[model samples]
Target: MSIFKQIKGFVFDLDGVITDTARLHTKAWHEIADQVGTPWSHELADKLRGIGREESLDIILRAGGKQDAYTDAEKTQLATAKNEHYQRLISTLTPQDILPGIPEFLHDLHEHEYLMSIASASRNAPAVLERLGLTQYFPKIVDPNCLHTGKPNPEIFIKGAAILGLEPRQCIGVEDAAAGVQAIDAAGEISVGIGDKDVLRGATIVFPTTSTLTLANISGRLKEAA
Candidate 1:
């Protein structure tokens, strides 16, 4: 039987999985790094995937060898600056930015009466969803602003499931980052990874992209895993 047969809810990550905001986030981080005279690269930005803003800032500061140079208040200011840049860039987002196949999948899930929630590490998730016309698809969104820790901690996924009124085992967590997969796994939920298998090692199933996912395909994978 399909494992999804028992699943009542889904927790989805926002950035790379539902949209292309990951690039925008990378751009914002790069801008911040440049302003601080830090050496920034795509490789460094990749490490920020699925991490919260402050934590991501910490990683960037450490990578630039300025971790100890900044006080807590200074770090907060840097993080805020990065977010300002990100918000300015994302202000132009529209419904057209929704990833391929995601709208159809969301509609299908809604029609099927499967409860869905967003478990993103981004504090700007609500604004992004609204801009993309996707706010109606998810009733619950775990607030990253309130979180002390981000992905790989399972707190966001756990909070998502709770808001959906379901147990961890009753929901599936979907993500496009390694830290996100680890979070889902740690939360005792099935993980559907939307990225390379090599990077999404802890995922229960891995899909090359969201465009390749379907309810039927997910069911099949669940059954096979079972």
Candidate 2:
């Protein structure tokens, strides 16, 4: 049995899961950090990964020790600057940015009659999907921009399952970030962590990368566990 055999729905995180846009996001953050007169260290950029745009901005600003340095009005100004930079960066995305076997993985899921959806913390998730020509694969999307609460809270994943008309137990949430994996667990859903294994510490199932995973293989794992 493959994990896919038991999963009625597949919930995915956009950036590092289906695409390699995490590096692009990090680059955008670094660019904006420089403009904000803040240093952009790799460690700081890593912390912002897999979170909402507003949340990322908050992290960056706070790390810069400018949380209270700017008024709400000024904070909005900074946010606008960051968005502009990120938007510009998004234009650089090509089909090549999509990870290996990702499109195939999605297609396989669809063929298996698994409902697919995107549940990302990024407000830019919709646009990212559009840019990657992957908008059609995901009929339902739940982004922080569409929710009051973000990841690491589980609301987003819960809402995503709701939109897909599935129970949390029927869906497998795929994520590449620690916060995202945590969110899935909090939602009472099975989580399959992709990419770095360290970040998926508590994840019940972990894969090094989507390229090496197959629906059949995952289904086998699920059956073995059962």
Question: Which candidate's TM-score is highest?
Answer: 1
Error of 2 at 164 (Å): 0.8
What is candidate 1's lDDT per residue for 1-226, written digit by digit as tens?
3567789999999999899999999999998888777898878988999888888888888888888988899888898889999999889999899998999999999999999999998889999999999999887999877777778999999998999999999999999999999999999999999989999988999999889788988998878877
Off by over 4 Å in 1: none
Residue range 107-127, candidate 2, lDDT tens digits: 888887889888987778788
For every model shown, the clashing-pair count is: 0, 7
What's the CA error at residue 139 for candidate 1, in Å?
1.7
The 10 consecutive residues of candidate 1 with the worst lDDT sum are 1-10
Question: What is the lDDT of every predicted structure here?
Answer: 0.91, 0.82
The lDDT of model 1 is: 0.91
